[model samples]
Target chain A: MGDVVLASLLLPLAGAVAAAVAPARRTVAVVTAAGQTVLAVVLAVTVLRDGPVATAPGGWEPPLGIALRVDGVAAAVGLLAAVVVTAVLAHACASPASTGPATEPAAGRSAYWPLTLLTLAGLQAVLVAADLFTTYVALELLTLGAVALVALGGRGAYGPALRYLCLAVLGSFAFLVAVALVYARTGTLTLDLAAAALPPGPALTTALGLATVGLLVKSALFPLHAWLPDAHAAAPTAVSPLLSALVVKGSFVVLLRVWTALGGDAALASVLAVLATGAVAWGGVLALRAAALKRVVAYSTVAQVGYLVLLLPLVTPALAGGDGVAVDVARTAWQGVLLVLLAHGLAKAAMFLAAGTLVGVAGSGRVADLGGTAARAPVVVTAYALAGVCLAGLPPSLGFVGKWALLDAALTGGRWWVVAVLLGGGLLTAAATARVLAATLREPGPGDGPPPGTPHGREEAPGATALPTPRAGERWPALALALLAVVTCVGSAWLADLVLVGAPPGVGG
Target chain B: MSTAEVYLVLGGVVTLLGAVRLLTTRDRLAQVIALNVTGTGTVLVLVALAATGGGEPDPVLHALALTGIVITVSVTGLALVLVRRLDREDDGG
Candidate 1:
């Protein structure tokens, strides 16, 4: 079991190297993705049967050698990553959009396969890392891969990629500073050991504050989220799904680990919840107004990130209450969080892939251009709408199950404000999603072409028969992911059980 | 105050200055330089922190500092390449 856990991480990294050298980069990438998916399922099943699995390489343990553990949370997240990454790779394989003019540079095209594999490897490392410094290193690898992937979008991507790099690098330094302080005080780098040894002092508080700030920036939470939309929107179509789905969540998992390790603080949780609310409102409004199709999906990611942070306030021991009540609430909230993360990753990736397909058919990225797309690309359009419904937490989708659990937890905690935000955010998300669906599903009016002499619309001929048909490869991957997002809700109870095994301290057995 | 304290203060001040300059600067090159300055200060702090142990400098912390240096170098190289790309794009126009 332990060997399988280790292979799940190493295989992708090894594949990255092989892809870098091999002439058949895509084949290398595909084979790696398929293998990793199998490893992830094996890891998940082993953990489910036997509880958490852990290993300290070379028989060395914490304080000297790093520990890698697969708890319930890590297993669930790893499974989500494997499935989503495979679907995304399948989508990329099917679509020519991955090698479009936006990725025209030779470096961009060839580098994508290796970078994708590297990112998967990095995420796996981040998931299992038991020490602060190791997590930091893993995060840096993840950031490097993500930044380079953004640059693969060619000219329009350079600015966003650079901005992302600067902020990400700065955030990493701040995280490193926190790690140093942590090591200084505890004389240990392993999370559990350091948490146990850490004295509550000015240094501990400072370290926690610095780590929170750094992670907030990396996770792109609210006001610190300035770098997300452009970077995500401008990324090559093949890369955007991975960036939006998984990379941002990597730091968030680290944040959850750090916050839990040091003990949750009510004040910090409340503050985070408030910022999350801001992200929901701010991101939804912007997404509603976003002109481009991909930008809408990008901004929606900002809003969804808000929902994920709601877990903090709900799970905080001080805020949730005492004894089994607290444990119960925390467990419910954690399950909700896992469901939200998984559902968002699958649904969001599907949305991006479908949006990419629509853009391909329309030959432009404008939401306006996507009007009447239902006729030309019904499968992709249906896929986009289904994913949007999942994002909005409609019935039968995994997102709905997740949000229901969150709402249930909030009600139990008697946090009326949180309950309001939960419901209100869903409505806002539905509205924003409706904007795009409306555009795509609407029939083209008789005056589809520019009236008289509109200069910008001159190039677009009305009812142009030149629109490309989305291939089965392009169409099927998005639909498959969308279907998975909805079908997974059927397994919500089983997923909740999986999340309970080796659950965190506040969440009971 | 001991030598370690002095180095800690120096590192903090340099990090602060670099961060402020990085935020305020409009020039991309200057921002990249500021990031490097910030990185250097952070590494100095990490090394200084090791010395505060009141014995031989800690190997683990030194290793962390070395790791930080490598990350900074690679990131800086990537950043400079991005700046050059943007510059070329502008020139092509």
Candidate 2:
């Protein structure tokens, strides 16, 4: 088990190094992503079968040395990171759109493989990091890698990337202060240990508040989401999926840790619930209004993030009251959030990858220009539509299952506001997605260029340029992921069971 | 007041100033510098707290402070690199 944890971390770091220096960087990256996926599955299975797996690196125990622990949350999210990274890498490996043209510099291309692997390493590290300070470091690695990936979009991306870095670093520093204060009070960096030892007071409350604020910034949850849409939309096509699907989730998981440790303070949870409501409404409206395909997808991310935060308010033990119903609500909320997270990751990756393909082929980012996309790239269009089903929480998809769980819990608990948000947010999501679907299904107008996927067809629409023939390699992965999002509903029962393996006190049945 | 309390107050004031500058400034380089200042302020607070154990400093707090500094420096380096890249884009475009 320890070896699994250690290898998961080191394998990617080592692959990152080799990819940086090796001539066959693509080969190295593909192999590493596949290997990491295997490791994640093994780790998840090991934890599910034998309970939680933890390791103390360098033979040192807690309070002296850091430990890497893989409980149910880590296993579920670790598997997510592996699967999403592999799918995006598969797409990137085949698409020259990720790298520059042959005449241009290869620097971005070379940097792409190594940085992505490093980001994966950071993700793995954060999942297993049992200490707050170590989480800070792992998150720094992830943030820096993600910032660079955004900049790979070239000049347009630089400003957003810089803004992302500045804000993210500020958030990290705030979190560090919280960690420092926690240490000053408790003398231990191990999270569970600190949580057990921490006494309620002004200082502890302040530490918790700081940690929440810091992580919320990183996760781009509403009011603090100023940097996200631009950064995600401006990132390289391949990088955008990874950023939206996985990067934001890392900080979110950390926030989950902090909240679970605090056992969901009612006041904090209520505040978060209000902010989440704002995000869903604001983000959904912006997504609806956004003209560019990628920005629409990006804004949808901001909205989806709100649903993730709804978990906190529902999970608060106060809601459970005395009938043991609150405990069941907390348990249901936890499972619902994780399922929503998994569904969103897979679906969002498919949407972005398909969006990139559409944008690339159309030679424009505008939704109006995608009118003929179905004729030109039917597979990509299908992928995008399938992803939309999950995004809108349509039936027989994992998104529906997750949202149903959330709705059931909210209705049972009589959390009317949460119920309103869930139902209303679903309508908004469906409406937002329908705009793109409507455009794609429209008949090709005069400016819409060619109607068929000719082997060598070029988009002759105004301001458009010739692109490489759309390859099967680029189109299939998006469909595969989108299909996975819909098909995984079959496993919802199993997933609900798996998430309870190391359930927190008062959380699971 | 004790020396530790004095340092803690100073650190708080400095952090507040840096945070204000970080929020108000639009200049890229200034923003980076402001972030560094804020991080230094945090380190200062950590250092002051390291002495709370009487005559001997808490080794763990000191270690955390050091780790904080290392992280701040690297992030600063990365921010500067980004600033320079942006500068090149400005010149070329």
lDDT for residue A203 in candidate 2, whole number 0-100: 80
For candidate 2, lDDT tens digit of each residue in A379-482? 99899999989988899899999999988889888889988898888888888888998887888677664334431112233543453335788898899999
Q: lDDT of model 1 at residue A122?
A: 91
Q: What C-alpha lDDT, on a 0 to 100 scale, does residue A197 get in candidate 2?
A: 89
Query: Which lDDT tens digits does candidate 1 get at residues A64-103?
Result: 6778898877888888888888888887777645643432
Clashing pairs in 1: none
**What TM-score does the A-chain of candidate 2 achieve?**
0.95
Scoring each candidate complex against the real one, what DockQ results? 0.75, 0.72
- What residue runs in model 1 are displaced by over 4 Å at the alpha carbon? A100-103, A318-321, A445-465
Choose the strongest candidate by DockQ: 1
Ten-residue segment with the worst summed lDDT in candidate 2 chain A? Answer: A451-460
At residue B72, candidate 1 shows an lDDT of: 96
Where's the lowest-lDDT run of ten residues in candidate 1 chain A? A449-458
